[model samples]
Target: MTSTLTRLPRPYQSYVYAYPHKTAYRPLAPRPTLHEVWAGEPRDPLSLYLHIPFCEIRCGFCNLFTRVGAPGDLTTRYLDALTRQAETVRACLGTEHSPRFANAAFGGGTPTFLEAGELIRLCDIAERVMGADLDAIGFSVETSPATATTDRLAVLAGRGATRISLGVQSFDENESRAAVRPQRRADVETALARIRDTAVDVLNIDLIYGIDGQTPASWRYSLDAALAWQPEEIYLYPLYVRPLTGLSRRDRAAADLAWDEQRLRLYREGRDHLLTQGYEQQSMRMFRRIDAPAPGPDDYSCQTDGMIGLGCGARSYTRNLHYSFDYAVSAQEVRAIIDSYTATTDFDRAVVGRAIDADEARRRHLLQSILQADGLPVADYRARFGTEPHTDFPVELARLAERGWLADTGPARLRLSPEGLAYSDAIGPEFFSTAVRAAMAEYELR
Candidate 1:
């Protein structure tokens, strides 16, 4: 049952993380009640996500569901709404279920964009409304080098944030400018110093390749500069210019074959460089220092556990459904959605989402697990599905193997070869069900 379709094009799509883009999600009419969504779902060891959708400035390549800067008291109003949403979610989970969050993350345009006092309140909401101890779990928060001020870093570190990921897309001034992310190298270095002064358990620096006019030498310089701090983790991302993003209006030649070839060369170069630096490749994008402290519960898996998302842009996942408030990439649409979210009182169930049937679930399980460098565990897949992954995704698996993207490394594992991992973006999309792709295609990109 191998796929008869043509292999997807190269320099390959980038699979930073996750699958089934939010565009694939449609409005759920007669949305299920939260309790109904969680019915018979395991309550222990869940993941919690708190989204702060405000940033000081929106980068050119950014298309995440976040807005640039807080308008007036919008920040205050947004936090209030988040609190209300958390309360509703917790109530729905119920006291009897005794939901224990195993891991938590604060992400957005930049969680550190909030003032020091605001950040304290954000942590309080997680503690009081959600019953998640900020200090007890593996808490990770996203920050920008410009926003990682000492006061903010102190607040995060004090609140039990184990990992702080700073988005330093590139250290080269021209590359940064080309990506429309302006900052002085001195500021980034100062922020790095301030972060280290906080003595946080893990420091993750994010770097982006494929910026317009970026070269191999420039990419190495950025990588080397990041390594100077001995960050616990590093994520190298390929820039994708999506619709409605700042970078979208750029010259058409930005995404040509020659540009892609340059990106691929830089990616491989950065990857090999990081490996030599004693960092382990967790995925194509994530590389962690060998000595970095292990974060998160080993038993918790996104496939099996539930997640609670507390902001308009945040998304919650249950066994059968993935949901969130309305999603938008355009600024006006994003503001409208945020305004609507702030005005809403009914926080009990999903509004915008796509229901996942058994087949979609299997596909998700495989797509999420197989993209990692370590690959998918056959025994675990069998234990959950009562059949081998090969049986469920025969066409997909066979095609990958035929193209040298997959290798059966052992009786208990089906892993992607390095080449296959390089093609993760292409491979991941191949597993998308026809219905999902069509739904996504039909979606209006507001």
Candidate 2:
């Protein structure tokens, strides 16, 4: 049986992180209040995410929910809206059921795009408005080399930011140009120096593989350059050209079998190289230094815990629903959503999301947990759902086993083999319910 399963074809899907794309989200009529959404849910340690959807420039291959540049007063208005939303959400959570946030992150087009003063105010919203202690919990922020200046880093560091993730897509100028991410190596080095000068405990540098004209040698060059910083974490991403992105118009040939083979090879090379450098693989994209301080609370688990997302681009998740403001890729639509988000006075519960039934919840639990280096624990699954994973996903489990992807199918646990982990992208989408696929397909691409 292990020899007979059909292997997926080339351009193998890479589900690097989270699943069920926001594209699948639909409008929720008569949106429920946040109080109603959290009524019976456990007030466990929650994760907080704030989205800053403005960037100095948009990369070609980028499809994230962010716009390029902020027009006059747009940043200020957006921040005001964020504060209002936070206050509203805080009120919704109420005093008694308010959750204790164990982890927090500021991500987006670029959180550092704001001025130093704006960054300080951003921290105030999290601390004073949302009631999160930045100094007590792990606080991470995403930045671009161009925006990560000394003053900005100092502000973040002063506010108790433990980790600073810089997007240094590549060290080679030509590759950066090829990815439509213009940046000089000098800028990255300068940013790294500034970040270090702030004494931030953890520095994460992000790199990309499989860019056009990026050869094995060039990949190694970028890898070696990133390792030179001895970053607490390094993320190697395989570039994907999505619709409406700047790179989408370039060429479709870049997504073929040969390209995938090159990407796979580069991924393996980076992984093996980092392992040799004494880094541990956290996921297909993340590698953590052995001695670095843990990035998040040990007790917080995204699989089961609730998340509070603040911003037009952020998505909040409860036990059964994941909701956010409208998602868009095009410049016009993003601007419109941001304008609406800023002008609105109502910050209620979910207004756009798909309801997660029991089966979907089980699938979400499995997909989120199993993709990690440590496979899912069967006992925990059974305890949570009162049934075995095999009982709910027998066919999928059998197919994985038939493909030699199951490492162990013990009574106590169901672990994926390393080879299985490599194919995580292919496995994750297989669990998407038929309803989700239909909804996503029907959703208009904004």
Candidate 3:
């Protein structure tokens, strides 16, 4: 169905963080038990993800499943619900055939939004109930400048968080405000100092390009500011104003082509700047220092293994399906889902998600690999799927090659050129399955 003599489409359609977005999911008919859903899947150590939905403020360009604030003991109630869900999930996985976890992560509006004591309790649930050794597993946590408190970070370090990602969209105060993320440069520096005081081994700084008033010079200032910390990893994200986000209310990008061109220019600038500073491109968004800390015992790859997610906003992925509770961006729907999750006691069923069939699996493998800097290994793909990627998706490959997106580095691997990686946000959607496209199209926004 994907056939056309190719011409380049607009780059930056969307960020393909995961194949088949959450919007593609639906309520499961004859809801399957967690056991049935995971049965026959590889019991190899899986990645554990815990989602916390509260944040001090939502970024203007963010469409994540998180809410603005937690009122009157709501966080405590949420953690209680998390504990209950963990207990149930642990019981379902059972003693005889339970899946072992290799690593863990805490993500959301901001996980460090919890107080030091509350953070300890959250760690306890992960360690005691979920059977994940945080110290040994090298867990990661996400935080914002406003919430990266010394007490909370100390607790995280003491409990074994190896990595902490601080979302400081821009060090330029004006650019920060333009992005609807209110914070002073002084506050951001203070937060960075607090994070460095902790024992965390790897620090990832998140920055964005394409803010409303961002210029090349202003963009370089933020990049240089982030480098001042010499973080282990850095992510330069292009600003995408998704539906229902604060930026989406107004027409921020009246001229789509101009916006895309601006983003591309900034992206190339950021990529080149990092490279010169001894960082290696891990993907379109991620760059790692050449001397970054070596992998620990808990090194887990998201491409191959399954993920067991806790909290209302998280999703659990098995080889056969990806399941999660209802997803939302609007504050009202998000609060409603969290309320329902906290009140519910039955946690054994796979209520809503999409089933991944054979074809979808191949596409996922292809998408995940090709988007990275290393690109896809042809031998690996053939061995895994018993078919060459080119043979299976001739039209897709043709379209990509026609655009000069594919490099002539040889047939040993299916790799995207530098320009291809630049166009990743566009290239990713080119491989989405027709069924998934339909499902996403039909999903109604709240």
Candidate 4:
């Protein structure tokens, strides 16, 4: 059994590590400034992402670009740099064009770690630079239970934040302690209550199963606890070990940490329980209210290269190219990365295309379609790519159908069965190239 597991395909190995921690990427050398990459469509829809890379304390499992320091005036300086980056992005994307900045997301170690006033300033700068009204934008912010206080909630509300994703990894005290993320359940409830009456219309709770002390029974209780909160969205993620993270070292040194199968079982059990509680499974890890806005059918995961990321270790993608800046290296490097943004550059289109292969795109569409209670729309796919979904990938789709993983809801529409939806993560990368597969394998080793 061990040898079989060791010899598993690269896609399977990669999928196992898809669980959450923090964003992982390398920084670009001799940081360049934002410049005009290939001009996107004149009226292309753009999303604004603000990276607030500051954390009170780093989680043992996190590999995100965040640091521990409450240096005086740090928030002010970070916001200033972010504003400059936004300005550069506005110029590069074309100022005169009213590109639809449909959504805005604030993510990081913990956005609420910054003073409320700092967050407001960042929002003000974003609105002024993007020329987009805050009321119409789909703004979301991520907060940790320890930092989200009544005051912070009020500041976020005032800034027109629409969604609040609370990092409530687990309600179990032991599990929380083991994860090195101690939070009072009451504090999280209070934060949720404060956001409930505010402009933050969506409350998404993030839960982590498959932790060191986690089991199916324990995870079941966690789900029940989460459902009691009645969050608009729930993201159930498995625990993953990353190199250099505090948790990885502990797990390695501990004589008896949880095994891989235990983690997998926890995920499977938790997912099944969530579906039973009336939440609609959206992506691989996200479950939303039945009526929430369904994510787009496009390969958004691979298309996230052009986003203008701010803060420490944030990455951006433009014209199918990827670039990142690291704040953890040094204050000078961080500032240099921000100032290096210019008006033009070469992007990795081929890499982007490879990242979101046809199989991956199809899997994303199918998973989202099922989550939305709709089947894949043949006409839309035809309209977007001038080809039918089945025509482009009949071999795989037909095989899945034969295995009862897919169902023909209509002439050109197919829906994933519950079983297929459960396997969505495993199914997405079945068509990656050998080279891509090898790269994924190497990533796993790191």
Candidate 5:
């Protein structure tokens, strides 16, 4: 277990988008069948995700499992494999489970990286093959400026995509070069215009801070540029230069106190600017326009429910186990993983995954809820877990209070203080179980 934090950890620790982090996952012994995995899981509704591991360009700071290009029959073969995986997954979920898909998302290197016709085929696999109703669900897609073509957006809009998230890391050309995300301001604007022509209910723009050569003035320039379009949502990500990424080969993003304080300053700047622009801060990375359209019925609550992911890089989560294919960051290793996935015929069992136990569940609930701006409802936590959060992890909670990271909102809630949310990256890892931390450390050494 990590020692009590009497002092502050680096502000830019690891991002906690998922619990147990995928790094903790290992090759399951005697792998559990999908049918068994879903046997007693909730059947009310689930989130659907289809991952495309192809991108036009690889960003320097990205460690996501994706390749730069899909040439010749690569896309076709990948889609065919996805179709097979979806059928197998649906058959395993079966009528006995009575699964209902409430919402869906197409994520990836770039889902829009496919051609216009390919996008249509991808939609067919989701609806016709997987039994999901895109037309009636809160469907979202991730895209990039180079691939957000008119025809592609038209197909997505026609297929009932409710939201589109475009990754425009930086509008400043120099900053982009520094991050190794090549693009021009003109291209980003053009893509935004094409998306506006569509009927998608929400549009999200992603920007990055802490890039080399990025100044407070330059960061504000990028923020003001994104604000001009009145996007429904904006995400300001702190740049991370992890091993196996392009930037890691360089000397940028030194993980010292200087880098941490610099990023903290930039985050405050971006957060304050968004609040003044009438945007509501949802989390450390997400800010939504105050008037942004509300989500539709059957929205997926990932914190509690299950998710079905049908891609090499995508991970599926049951209440206890989270599983997926092998993860790789380098181009060669990623290509090898994708090749294995495309050639695979048996998609019935979970080969690689981590099993979440009872104790971790409480920690996950608290960490996920506390990281958000709204905080966690203590009553709900007690009702569900049948115990108080403070009872489960007294040392962790007390340390937070001691650091002035935990807020006092009376006994009804367990929420992070404003200062706590600012250091969410540090706080999230404090909850990582000893088992998970060891596994992650072992993976890094390998």
Candidate 6:
């Protein structure tokens, strides 16, 4: 069946109504037990994702599971549980297997927003559970530009953080004020200079292209400032106005907001500019130094099967199952994440049935696989699944090819064209849509 969406911007119009946004959800196909896949198995590599949900303040555009002024004692309570959770995660490893860690990311409303003591304690928990060979691990932490302080950077280095992804949405004063993100350009530069001199191996700046009261000029300026810092990595994201947030509050009247055409153009410019500066396009949003290279495709998060999540709203994908816990929110929001994660089960099956569905698994592979520095290996897929992408996704691949959105450069190699990368969210329907995925898709497109 041939169909197209009729919006405008020609390419977008073709995707206007091709298919209903929602795709059928296929529950996870049966897989081996967690013990078998992760315990002592020689499966995929491993990483750790720790979530810290407290922030000194909130951003207008942020919808992450975080809160400001969450009880003064919140950090203490969270660290206690975090320690226990780390132990629980460590217990999952078989006695015979060696601890293998490729990366560890401390992400949140602002992980640096935590008190120095709490930050130190949490890092202790990581070292205790995973050990101190972190010198070999690609450890990363996220922070808002405003919160980047000398003390905070010092704490991160103490905890073995090798990279910092600072959030600097825009350089324009008006745009920063509109988004309620208060950080001067000078502050970010000073902070970066200090961080660069630290033990941290990589410096990553996160820039948002589309936002209320932001224009191409503003975005270009932000890009220029980020480039001036000469970070080892740069992540470019477009502004997304999600429902029920401060962003949605002013999204309607924001003429500076770059939607379809403008958003696309801004992204292209970022790519062109970064490429000119000797940064290779590692993925849609990420650019890295040519010689040093990134670990894999999904550098933001680990692509491996064993990711241990700590803190409220943290998500862990073990070999066979997934588990998550959130810090105490109002009775309402807690129930929401819990409900969504534990949907399939009556009481907590949704969360308990955490194994990823085949479709989602497939989609994850596509996104992360293409982004791989080593590139996707066709033989590797066949060895694992006993089938090829062409055999498994014949229809989907055919559709994408028909639209000239993708090209099969080799048996296992597929690349998204500029148009496809710009509209990459369309690839998600082939899998499931949790509230998070829906939110991510809507935000990425916006």
lDDT of 1: 0.86
lDDT of each structure? 0.86, 0.86, 0.89, 0.61, 0.89, 0.61
Regions of model 1 farther than 4 Å from truth: 1-8, 14-16, 253-255
TM-score of each: 0.96, 0.96, 0.97, 0.77, 0.97, 0.79
Residue pairs with backbone overlap in model 2: none
Model 6 has an lDDT value of: 0.61
> Candidate 4, residues 1-446: lDDT per residue as tens digits?
35322333211223422211112222334334344343653334555677876787777667665666547766666777667666656666665666566566788768889877777787787788755566666578898877787788888788777788988888888888788777677776777677676746788989987677777777877788888878889988766665566677663532222354565567678777777877767655788876665433232332222345544445554543344542333334434543433211332211111233454444444444543335567776666556777776777677677766675576766677765554555555553434545544544322
- List model 2 lDDT by residue over 1-446, tens digit each: 32112346343564536656787788998788888887788766988999999999999989888998998999999999999899889888888876788989999989999999999999999999988899999599999999998888889999999999999999999999999999999989999888888888999999999899999899999999999989999998888888889999986774377677777788888889999998998876789999998776789887788899999998888888888888889989988998899898888767887677798889888988878877788888888999988889999989889988788657777777766766777787788888877887887886
Candidate 3: regions farther than 4 A off = 1-7, 253-255, 297-299
Please provide, for model 5 over 1-446, each residue's C-alpha lDDT reduced to its tens digit, 9 standing for 90 to 100: 54223257788889999898988899999899999998889977888899999999999999888999997899999998999999999888878666788998999989999999999999999999888889988698999999999999999999999999999989999999999988999999999999999968999999999898899999999999999989999998998889889899986545466777778899999999999999998999999999999866745666788899999999998889999989888898999998998898889999899888898888888888889988888887887889998898899889999989877898888888877888999989999999989999889521
Residue-level lDDT tens digits of model 3 in 20-40 = 799999999989998788777
* Candidate 4 weakest lDDT stretch, 10 residues: 344-353
Which is the better candidate, 2 or 5, if ranked by lDDT? 5
Judge candidate 5 at residue 62 and give its lDDT: 91
Which ten-residue region of model 1 has the weakest summed lDDT? Answer: 2-11
lDDT of 5 at 327: 89
Instruction: Please identify model 2 stretches exceeding 4 Å from their true place.
Output: 1-7, 14-16
Q: Model 6, 38: alpha-carbon shift in Å?
A: 5.7
> Compared with the true structure, what per-residue lDDT tens digits does model 6 show for residues 298-322?
5333333556566556655643455
Is candidate 3 or 4 superior in lDDT?
3
